[model samples]
Target: MSTVIAYVDGFNLYYGMRAKYGHRYYWLDLAALVRRVRPQDSLVGVRYFTAPVRGEPAAAANQSVYLDALAAHSPAEVETVLGRFAAKRLRCKTCRGPLTCACTPPVSHRTYEEKATDVAIGARLVEDSALRASDVALIVSADTDLVPAIEAAQRLDPARAIYMALPPGHMRPSRHFSTVGYFNINESALRACQLPALVKDAVSGAVYARPAKWH
Candidate 1:
């Protein structure tokens, strides 16, 4: 039996699903989804990378519920790794332009940028390969930064197969990811692999319900 581990990029996967299919698939079962995607292999583990919402309280609550549900249901198969965001200031493009205008006023806004997710995924990918934890690494993302990690994993263990599973609606992957074989996630599979409306933690007896907005 071939051992397989899946690396999930939470932000990429969330945006892709919402953009392509809307919020219907937000309650996805990661292990079930991976099983549908790769039925031939034995799924050993799944690593999910994401960061908390900064300003949106409702969205943050929904995210917490979903993550808790995943943990409550598939505690043994899935692991959630959190990243952080850094706030940065951005100036208006009109303020700094080639053409000088009298009405060009200074405008700036603070925005948060996701940090450490790609690095975390890369580190896990390479580490797993080095440890021979799985015969195959199924990376679910379109991020270009992970290419070097995939390449390094292949170099570290020539026998381990690393494959890229692009999120929905992402047709073009970076040139760096071309060397690795790819697969496009289908909406039908996602539709079939959804978490239940309610889940309870066996140990703590804490219940997690699906968010109403996701309905």
Candidate 2:
């Protein structure tokens, strides 16, 4: 059986799921999801890339709980890679106009951009390919920014297969993801692969309950 390493784009998957199904699929089992996506392969591990929410305490807390649950799940090996959020302040174009202008003044607001995620994924993908970590690299994301990295990995070793799986109800995913194969992920699989309502840390023995917002 081919060995597979599943790379998950945490925000991409989360936003896609939220857009389509609210929080119905938020409580997920990474291992079970990977197995459902590729039942024929041996899942070596799952790398989930995401950044913590900076401003919303409730949302941040929810994210923490979910990550903890994933950590507690022993059936599937998962590694969490945290990125960062870049907050920038800028004035609106309209507000930058001349003082004599009758139009409303430009408003300055802070915007948060998710940083280092795609770059990290790309780098990790190439590094793993070069190291021959697995026969197949399964990236569960529709981000086209990864195209270049995917290309580099394939060039490193043409025999290394790169598989892509899009989130359920995802629309307009990149068509260039079929280098070697595609993994099927749907709402049914997500619904069936949910983690238990309460999970205990495999090592720490602390119990984590599913966030009520997620339920």
Candidate 3:
């Protein structure tokens, strides 16, 4: 039996799901979603990498509940790596007037944002590869930022198999690594992995949990 390790990019996947199927679907049981793609003889374990919500109290509380649910549901199968938040410089090009508009000055500002998670994920990939943890690596992300890590892993051990999982309806090839497989969680799969609607948080009261549905 081939062993597969899955690395999920939480933010990338969240936006992808939102882009494909409107706003209602947000809460997702990642472990359950991955199981839908598992082959009978494959699928050893899944590693989910995500950063916690930093500012908003309500949002943070809700996220805590969802994370708790994931842990409670699949204690053995799922492992989560928490990431940090960072400030990034944003360049905004403003447009003036209408169709025959002139380009305004580019504004640069720093905003506190979710930190790059690919670094942690990349480190884990290399670590696992060095230890010969699994037969294949399944990375659930479309961010090309992970190209170096993927290439390094292949260079280290030429036999390690690397695959990609694009979010539903979004497909793109990586600049560095050629994707072997592209797994998209469609509506049917989402339906199979959807979490319960009502979630209780320690800090907040009952919050509405909307799991991503298949579209």
Candidate 4:
């Protein structure tokens, strides 16, 4: 039996689900979702990597509840990686006209926040490889930032199998990175893992309808 381990890019998958099914489907059981994809006699463990909510007290509390539920269902199966939000500055080309226009910092700087998840993911991959814990690795992310880490893993174990699970709406692989094979999680899979109505948000009383089809 081949030992399989799954590595999920938290923000990539979360936004992907939101984009495909809207915020209503936010309550997802990731381990259950992956089990649907596992082949018999091949799965050994599943790993999920994601950062916690940065702001918004209500949203954070909701996320914490969901995380607890996930852990309760699969105590040893799920592994979470924490990432921090960092702010970045961007300059608008239109704001500064052509060469004649003087460029001055806007009265209010534009701040964009993003989660730092790549480094932590790469480190974990290396750690797993060192322990020889798995025979095959399944990476669920579309970010090319992981190219180097993937390559390193292959170098460490030439026969190691590597696969990718691209988020919905992704049609092409990154030019900088490619995988031996890829799987796209479509609407059907998303719907299959949709949370039930009872545990749905109690505040807004929102409930998600399952997708009509299954993948």
- What TM-score would every model get versus the actual structure? 0.92, 0.89, 0.77, 0.77
Instruction: Name the top lDDT candidate.
Output: 1
| Worst lDDT 10-window in candidate 3 | 94-103
The C-alpha lDDT values of all candidates are 0.90, 0.85, 0.72, 0.69
Q: How many clashes show up per model?
A: 0, 1, 1, 0
TM-score for candidate 3, please give it: 0.77
Best by TM-score: 1
Question: Model 2, range 4-110, lDDT digits (tens) per residue?
Answer: 89899999889889988998789999888998878899989999999999878998999998998888885359999999998866554787632333547744456
RMSD of 4: 6.3
How far is each candidate from the true structure, as Cα RMSD in Å?
3.4, 3.5, 5.9, 6.3
Model 1, position 45: C-alpha lDDT score: 95
Can you list the residue pairs that collide in candidate 1?
none
Candidate 4 residue pairs in clash (backbone atoms < 3 Å) = none
Candidate 4 residues lying further than 4 Å off, grouped into runs, are: 88-112, 195-215
Of candidates 2 and 1, the better by TM-score: 1
Error of 2 at 51 (Å): 0.6
Stretches of candidate 2 exceeding 4 Å from the true structure: 93-108, 178-180
What lDDT does candidate 1 reach at residue 137?
93
- Residue lDDT tens for model 1, 96-180: 5243235549344567889999999999999999999999899999999998899899998889988888999888677888678
Q: For model 4, where is the 10-residue window of minimal lDDT?
A: 206-215
Residue 73 CA displacement from its true place in model 4, Å: 1.6
Q: Between which residue pairs do clashes occur in model 3?
A: 187-214
